[model samples]
Structures are given as structure tokens and as C-alpha cells.
Target: MSSRQDEVPTLTQPSEATRRPVIYDVTRIVTRALNAAPNGIDRVDFALARHFLARDNSARGALICTAIGPRLADPDLALETIEGVETLWREDGDAEADDVYRRVVEALGSKGFSGASPTRARKTPNLLYLERNWRAMRRWAPHLGRPLRQAPADAIYFNVTQFLVDRSWYMRWLATRPDVKPVFFVHDLLPIEAPEFFRAREALLHPRRVSNICRYGAGAVVGSQALARRLRQYATEKGRPELPICVARLPVSPSFLSPAEPPEAFGGVNYFVVCGTIEPRKNHLTLLNAWRALARDPAPPKLVIVGKRGWLNDAVVEMLERSVVLRPHVIEAGGLSTPGLRRLLAGARALLMPSFAEGFGLPVAEALAAGTPVVASDIEAFREVGGDAIDYIDPLDGLGWLQAVRDYATPNSPRRRAALERNTGTVAGAEEFFAKIDEFIVRL
Candidate 1:
């Protein structure tokens, strides 16, 4: 078993002359159990922390680990802690628990399903579970060293994950630090732009988060030009016309670049993979419906759904749990390791992403990096990342998606052949991404 360090890009030490004063707020990486499956933002935060430490070998670069309150720590120590946690995270023990639960549920028959009914007063054990985790996490707090006494420099970088923007204390602390400039990485404006897909509370909170960024941030980094433009428009509307915004597209994770033996999960069967959380915005229902239509076909290809269940997706859950037609064809692989995901993508007929919206589509880039075909939504972010290499279709076009999937599923697919031809040569690497960020920092 190769470690994650072997698979993901690591920051190499830079010349002393090029190092700058930078502090990374690693609140998300430290607090979150990232060893379990991490979403896109978590990956970005983790990568950014590593990348920042790589730039400087001395105290000029530091990492601040915070959960509700900020704490300053040695960058090296933070990195070590992050690596340790990630190693432990990769050895996720959820599968064993899930297997046990499955056995219990199976034994109970329909009663197992009925136990989760709305009529029953749910016994909330989550609070107790959280308390246990919190106690364990507190053991690491001693190693966090001390609270941030003062800003290290004139500028600081924060890539807000875990919705830390809404925390009043942190924002107030940031506001008071007039000497320090905050450069934030705005992954997306999805909550504000497409509020219907998110919870009402999140929709309400996101505007405030964006407003705070505009007010307190020295500059903002966006993954796409489209997002950068959107941020500028938002800032201007909020009376910050001259807010500095730059485009620094995210790089493909090095794990996806490594070669892997195709997993036996596919059993040599041609299958299409849909990566990311199963949520309303990802349009999983559309894919499920299309698969339902294809179920009648004598030689239909398999569809592998590769993400954990997320909120506002009861319909998708019901279909996955109860649909007879989808049962044989659709495989829900919720917890795949990085290596497993790379192997799955590498062996797939094509990566299918029918997202209704996106800030930056990482999976599209990852599939291209793995030399696999991609059939993604015709969104600007996908276009920016995939260029002419991908096959794009409207997310709502059920027949169109079904047809594209069928075409690519063919043994000798022209679309697949074209994707292979176009995806040749390296996709963007972290070196370029870091260079752009470094250049932006210097300009600041």
C-alpha cells in the first residue's frame, strides 16, 4: 500500500530568496476527519496547506489550526499532524460498521426500513457520538502550541472551508487585524447563485459570507474566470468596486496521475462513472432516470455512482434503495480510496458528470489526467478545464445523455477514441498552480 504522499503532489522546498511571509489558516484540515472520504473543498484546503509549507522552510511560513478559536503552531508540526490524520483517514473503518448494520437491517426485514419512519421519535445518538469525537480531538489541542498572538505579516491567506466565514469570533478577529491582509480562495458562489439547490439557511448565510469576504479580504482567488467575474460583480454590487480578484485554476491531484490496475469491481464490464456527492445539484436523479430507460435494453452498460449520500436527495435514495430496474445495473460505491477512484476512472468507458452548475469541475480534469473519456455538462467550468477533449451535453437532456452514454459504451466508440487522442500530454500540474499563486502573492 503506497502512502498518500506518493500519490498526491508534495511541496518542494523553494530557494530562501523566493520565500515570503505567509500564514495558512488550516482550520478545516485540522478539525475535519479528512481520512474519511473528503469532498472537493477539503482536498483544496489540504493541498493548499501542503503547498504553502513547501514555499518556505522557516518561520516566515506558518499554519494556524483553529476550531471555533484560532491557534498558532509550527508549520512542520501542522503538516506532520495533517499527514498522520490523513494516513489514519485512508484506513477508514466505516465499511466494517456498515457491514454490521447491513446484517442487522437484513435480519429485521421490512421492520428495519420502517424503524426510520417519521412517525417514530428518533433517538438522537449523534450528540453522544460527537462528544466522543470531540474528546478525542481535544487530546491534540495541547500540540496546537498557542493562540495566534499577532499577525505574522501584512498579508494572510485563508481558503475558507467548513463554513468558517459565518463564525463571528473569527471574522471579528480578522476584522481587527488591520495590519494583515486576507486573501481568500472563493471556490464558488453556488449558494448565492443557485440557492434553490441548497438549504434555505445556507442560502441566507452565503450572502453574508461573500459580503464579509468583500469587506475584509485584501484579494480573492477564484478557480475559474467565470467565478472571478462573478466575484467582481458581487463585490462591485456590495460597494467594493476595486477589490482585487485573480484566476488561479486548480491543478489535478497527483494521485489521479499514477497508473493503477483496473479494479475487479467492473469485472471487465463497460461502466460509466459519476463522481461527487449524490445531491440535488449534481443531477443524480437525471442519470438514474436515464438508466431506468436504458434498463429495458438487452445490452445496456453499467452505471457506477461514486459518492456518499448528501442532503435534499430523498428521491435519489429511494431509487437506489428500492428500484428493481436500477438494482442490477447501478452500483453505489460511496467510499472509494484515492487509489480505488483512480483505478475506477482509468478503467471506465467514460466519466459522466451531469452537474447543473460548477465553480471548477475537478473530476473532469482527473478523468482527463487518467486518460479516460469524459461526458460532462456543457457548463463554462467544464469547458475551461476540458477544452475540446470532452463530450458535452445539456444536463436536462435525458435522451441526449442516454444516447451519449450508449455511444461511448460501445466497444469501439469514436467519441471515446477522440477523448483518448485529445487527452494526451499532461493536464495542468500543481507547479503551475503554485507559480500562479506565488506570482499573485508577490504582486500583493
Candidate 2:
């Protein structure tokens, strides 16, 4: 591994065909900055942007998907947008003074701080930054000093986020720019595999997303080999069986890799955390039910559900708003920044993820990286990421989840003790992840 750096090829001139230059499609991360709803895919986009922009070569550009069509953002504006998104997303920093972290700590110790802050006090994103950037890009139609008659040619455009993959305009960008080769970073096939857990429209739209990749993509990248195999199968189903694909085994962000702040002992307020959107597929109902049953205990550990609310969540919302018995034990701290999540996970009894399906179960790896134990469902993705370091249970086994949470909450339970002993830090590396992408580019 020490000498692999010298042996590895770079994306700049990996092969004869792709030596022209690179153009990253980073529309998703820019828009995500305004909403503060960044998930795994957004992280991938940000990482890719940073990786490319750091290179000494100045030939690269970011293709911004706009209302009219795709607009090419020159190097300077692209760097500004990438760095701005990094700051807005709270990707760098400690949790010591973070508003969300303090809020979570306060909520755990006091009944007054239920979960989310008052609607009036909520921090609305400063839109002025985006407005300025947007205005600047509107005038950047010439593609890096190129004449209006000429277009950026022989470039590899990476669509890491499936933002507008299914749209006709998105396809048209490729149709018109035949010299550009399209590559995608596919996160999952869960929408197609587990339609019951998603809204009807997601199931309908995902096929088109897959079709776009299969039909036009020069190659594809996935996090896990499990996903790589499934993506190949999807391509075969889409009549593009020979599609080029690579697996990089998703890299853990540096923010999570840093040592987590020591867990604050606030009046002995012990709790666990479940990190994901409050949607049906995540199987939050199972944990809610388990916690509801735990309410009978004289001193039950708390559960912090960390993620924004997602679609088709009437039942989850109803339970959250109406269940008085579970109120004392649950906190829904949605839209938490990375540092805030790190602090919360550091102090948690365990990170609970009983999702029925996942593409790559990032939260489990994140929890483990925080030196926190995870009690996840026995799914392939979790197994791939966590291996035997964390405990796994059936997502459907409500009683099993209840028992595991109860045992993990104990001061010296064997499961929790074993998991903590097995924690050896994160295995995912940024260099390795990009090395795989570089090799894939060589093949392309």
C-alpha cells in the first residue's frame, strides 16, 4: 500500500481517450447548500469536486445543471461554490460550540428541549450567497473563455448525484455533447427493489434513472461490490450488460475520521441514536415500538432519531406527535450537521439502524468510526460495511431489537463490551477510493 501511490494512474491523463480534460457535474451539492438537507450522495459530490479542484491542472470545470440547460462554471466560481457548500454543510469543525450539538445535549437533560427548536427561531439559510453565485454563473455561458460558437469537447462529465438523471434535458446534454463521456455514481437500487417502502413516484422514476445510466453512461461507480453486482444486473436488465463499473467502497469523510469529542455526561442522560430519514424504508416504527415497550422500565435509555423527515411518513409523524408514553424517551434531532452527528454518536449507547433496505448503510460505518457500537439489521450492506464489529439483528424482529437495545444500554453488557473492544477505526480511505476511480478512468 505504501508504494501504490506511485503505481496508481490519475484521472487527468489516465488514458489516451480521456486525456482531454475533466468536467464534474456538481449541481446537487450547490442546491443542497441552501436546503441543509445533505445526505450521502451530496457528500460524494462535494468530495469529488474537492478532489478535482485540488489538482494543479486548470483544465477542469463544473457543469451546473440549470433551468435552461447545463451551464459550465469556470474553475474560480466552481472552487467558490465547492468551498461554500463545505462550510454551509458544516463539514469541518468540532462539535463543542455547534448549535445543534448544544441543542441535542440540552434536550437529553431537560424535558423543555423536546427536539427541534421553535419554528420561529429556526435558522433560515442565507440565500444571498447562492444568489450571488447564481448571478455570476448566469453570465458564464462561454465555457471558460471559449467562444460562444465553441463547446468544451473531449471531456468526461461525472454525474455523481442523480439530480436530473431522468429528465429529458439531462439526456439532451449528452445527446448534444457527443464528445463528452458520461459516468455516474450509483448509490442504490432500493427504490426499485423495495417499492413498498417508498412513494409510488420514486419506484417509477428510478427505472428511468437506471435506464439513463445503462443507455448513455461511459461507466459507473458504486460503493460496495454488492452494489456493483446489482448495478450490473440492472444494466443487463436494461440491455447494457457490458457496462463498465467500479467499486470504491465509500470513503468516510475526514470530519468523521477525526477523534470525536468525549461524550458529555449530562446528569446521567444516556441514550442511543438512529441516523436516517424518518421514512418507512428506514423502519423507524420498529425502533419506536421497541422504545414504547421500554417505557415500562423504571429508567429506560433514550433514543435520538437524527435525520430530517422524508416522504410517506404519516404514521411515523402521527406516532411522534401523539405518543405521550414515548415522549420522555425519544428525541427527533433532524437536519443535524456532521459535527453535531459526531458528538451525538460519540455519546450514544449504540447507533440503531433497523432499516429494511439500504444501498450502503453509511450511518453504521459512521457510528463505528465514532467508536460507537451499532445494532443494525442483518442486511447485506450493513454486513459489508460493519463486518462483525457491530451487532446485527433482523429488522422485522421487534422483540429482538428491544432486547438488544436493552442489553446495549447496560453498563457492562457483553454485546456492547465486545463491539467496543473490536472497534479499530475506519478502513475506508479517500486515496484508495479515488485510486479505484482513476483505474476505472483508464479502462474507460
State how far residue 146 of model 2 sits from its true place (Å).
6.9
lDDT string, candidate 2, 192-259, tens digits: 88898889999999988989999999888888878877888888888987787877888877667777
- Candidate whose TM-score is highest: 2
Q: What TM-score fits each model?
A: 0.83, 0.88
Off by over 4 Å in 2: 1-20, 56-58, 111-153, 263-265
How many steric clashes between backbone atoms does each model show? 1, 0
In terms of TM-score, how similar is model 1 to the real structure? 0.83
Per-residue lDDT for 67 in model 1? 45
lDDT by residue (209-320, candidate 1, tens digit) is 8888888878777788778778888888999877777677788777777775564433557678898988899999989899998888877777777777788999998888
